[model samples]
Target: MSNFATPETRFLIGATGSIAVTRLPEYLGALRTAFGGSYTVLMTHTATNFLSPHAVGLSAERVIAREAPEDWPTDKPSRLAADHDIVLVLPATANVLSAAAAGAAPNRLTTVLLATERPVLFFPHMGTAMWRNPAVRRNVAQLREDGRIVVDPVEHADRDVVTGVVATHPALREPDGVVTAVRPALAAS
Candidate 1:
């Protein structure tokens, strides 16, 4: 391992089943504009549903998709943490938020979340009702308490229903050198 400080930062974009996935191209463009030569991106399966791997791969200058161990040369574990500095989960869904809060690592994205020692940033997007759910609230609270950066979503009228709440705007700026540490909430019996 190299002893260099401030290795080039790569973004791990873990998107769940949110409409926000549709905006990936813009997000990727923004990231490229901001970080350009300094970032690489990895995408989640659900995100691929909205955007093609080729598009994201072209934008990031590398392949973008899930990383499975069985895939071997195609999906190496090291790729998630290799020469990277941070993991940012944009459009994080309630399900993923709950999984992270519960320390579950069932899928590739969640598994990467568990493996990365770098700072984690979560930008959650979902219905206002779901955001306010006790479980989601607890998860958000826990993630915040655990030293993860949780960016607040901007509320707006739902395009689908025309009256209900939805997350319309994105939190775009990237923070520098933010670190969050997690401590167990309770002592083991």
Candidate 2:
């Protein structure tokens, strides 16, 4: 035998389009520092609207956006996916969740998800209404059934919601949350 338990690990982080994109710096920074592992960030096209690719990159040219050149090879994702130990999608959008559940790989991020057998941990972020939408709920159920892990977002009353009718939920995943969730998974893998 061979034991899968190993210390050094590699991570593939997929950051989706969500306002929580702004806080990724803190969480990702912590994961890189505390986890002692290298990570590559694959940002969705819309995610760039919230933060620049350079900012997400830190010092390494490890960040790749969805807007690849037309000449970029179609098999790039599989080649990249083969290198990572796990896949974690932070600020995962409702649309992304649905697409993954529906087996739609429109972008490199989803392509990586499909092309690899690596474990996936999805941290979904969206408004309360969107989170509770029938389709979104259905997708979440399907994803869970398919063996994808999720870190549930906390719901709180938004300052703008004076009536408290709907809670504004954001997946502002802190560094501690990332470290806590990733450590056990990394150890097992």
Candidate 3:
């Protein structure tokens, strides 16, 4: 693909289930504002709990989440990789990370994660305990080894009454951080 060296205007976003899922509109707004491109957001099945498919659909050119009842077009993943330059995963949960590390394609998000040949940026989000888990770290390391860009999470704690531990605030909150990490993927044209 001749376009691999430069940035692309069409972005495919893979969002997972996390409290951070609610901030998608803000993130998409900033990216669209700064880069002037179209956005397509695909939410993991669990993600729909926190964000509405219709609402996300309103903000983006298209929306496909795990909750979508109809099967995704089987050919869309490759078509997407061909047409879009960037693939971003925000709040990449441990389960999804594990699935991606193994190259599993049981669902649309993981399928796109594996199928896309374009730059894939992952912003991992989870509780400190979960993030620190050995399995999670190994998966993160593996994905990074495979060339994914991971913007480190910041320190923000909101205590859970049940868990009594703080969950992280994903870097996705700062659209600037996403833009910063994506610049390398778009350096030339």
Q: Which candidate has the top score in lDDT?
A: 2
The segments of candidate 2 whose C-alpha lies over 4 angstroms from its true place after superposition are 1-7, 59-61, 69-75, 161-167
lDDT (10s digit) by residue, model 1, range 25-97? 6775665444443445566677777777777665565654755556666555465665456666766788888
Clashes of 3: 1
Pairs in steric clash, model 1: none
Model 2, residue 121: distance off in Å is 0.6
TM-score of each: 0.74, 0.86, 0.84
Deviation of model 2 at 127, angstroms? 0.3
| TM-score-superior candidate, 2 or 3 | 2
lDDT of 1 at 136: 85
Among these predicted structures, which one has the highest TM-score?
2
State each model's CA lDDT, in order. 0.62, 0.78, 0.76
The local lDDT score (0 to 100) that residue 66 gets in candidate 1 is: 59
- Weakest 10 consecutive residues, lDDT, candidate 2? 1-10
In every candidate, how many clashes are there?
0, 0, 1
The superposed Cα distance between candidate 3 and the true structure at residue 189, in angstroms, equals: 8.3
The C-alpha RMSD in Å for every predicted model, in order, reads 7.2, 3.9, 4.0
